[model samples]
Target: MATTEEIEDLIARSALGDRAAFSRLYDRTSAKLFGIILRVLKDRASAEDALQDAFMKVWRHASRYSANGASPMTWMITIARNTAIDHLRRRKETVDADDAADRLVSSTPTPEQSAVAAGEARRITACLDELEQDRGAAVRGAYLEGRSYADLAESFGVPLNTMRTWLRRSLQRLQECMAR
Candidate 1:
């Protein structure tokens, strides 16, 4: 790994469109960056994907990095972590009733175990059921899938403003429910 001063100097040159400097920076940081992504994603393929995306970001955003603030490695690690989280969120979008059923069926439970899970699920269901159906759906779609409101609006076939309203209202309702 390059020393901190060396990495910062490379970042400065990279910002000036020096490809060789950027390549050296990549060589110095890829292992640490991969490690950070792997910790968040817990899947080798996903971690590799995140690492690639993060380096692309580094190449583009090298000008924004500063030695006085975070070290280049830390900045790179943050990029990797965010990218992995984004991948996980996007991967979750396919989850819905059918998928949930499949997940439940794949894991059989003893009677006592089933009862405990049922009780917790019942409470959660009751709280969610209190919200209007659309509001509930909006909250679940955003929270569980980590999809943006814009994406949900497109999926819901509603206007973007309407989707925003649904999300805002849904959050308020959930807050009120949880408060009690």
Candidate 2:
């Protein structure tokens, strides 16, 4: 694997429209980025499409990367993730309106029930806030958004096991906080 400094340098060069640098960066990072897209999309064809869209964005937006303040890999992974999410949203928009209406009708809660749910949501948010910011965000991504551990690891630039450990510890902390 390329070191962080090497990746940063490659990104900088790519920002200057150096095709060779962009090629090198893609060779080094495509697998990890593809894994992230696949986790979000859960279909090889859709993931491949999303990955292509993400790299196209990277090619176009590399110059803005440094100004964004994210580490190079994180910035790229965010692009891939957002691309997959946008694709999913577009797919969802194509769902039959009748199905959506049925879902809305079946899922509506009474005002009293909504109040209780809102209170629970507030408690959960408070507990999440008590954790470190990254941990809290990871928890939200995994549980709320259904992101896989592999995807979270790639996005956070951590090893899979390390991501799992972070989540395990964070969940324990959240459980403790919620219990209180």
Candidate 3:
């Protein structure tokens, strides 16, 4: 249990990019932060994930910590709690997105729905065909085969970051084409 002055000193050192001080701060406070996250998240895995996020934020924003008579532990607790809430919200959004995706990709369709789907598929194909080089095939492989960016990068003989940029730009172009 570090004293408040010691914790403040550790944070100050961490702000100065002292890895040792940051490590000490983490050792001293991670348990309490993890407990706060767990209380909000209500699941071990999510709480653990939020704990890591909170610490990463603390590390990145150590210079932003204001010591205006506020306790260091309270600041960390606030960060952990907010991170857990954000994780919970993202989890909820993912569930909703999954539901929306299921509706979009349903196997069964009415005649009208089939007509709309056919038109959309034709538009998508047209947009994909408009893509120069093998971009279209890469997009299909990514979405249809559930392949990862790393896999695509290796298959296409490009760096991982390059593949990611290619995919991003390709998707943007596709979106622009589809909107027309």
Clashes of each: 0, 0, 0
Model 1 residue 2 lDDT score: 82
Task: For candidate 3, write residues 49-99 as lDDT tens digits.
Answer: 878888887777777675322357756666676677667667755522221
Candidate 1 lDDT by residue in tens digits, 20-118: 999998888899878766765678987788788878877777777752244456566666666666676667665322211111112335667655644
Winning model by lDDT: 2
Ranking, lDDT, top scorer first: 2, 3, 1
| lDDT (10s digit) by residue, model 2, range 72-118 | 68678777777777676567555332211111122345667656655
Worst 10 residues of 1 by lDDT: 97-106
Check candidate 2 and list the clashing pairs: none
List where candidate 3 sits over 4 angstroms from the true fold.
Answer: 67-69, 94-180
Each model's lDDT comes to 0.69, 0.77, 0.73
Model 2 lowest lDDT segment of ten? 97-106
> In candidate 1, residue 12 scores what lDDT?
87
Model 2, residue 149: distance off in Å is: 19
Model 1 misplaced regions, further than 4 Å: 94-180
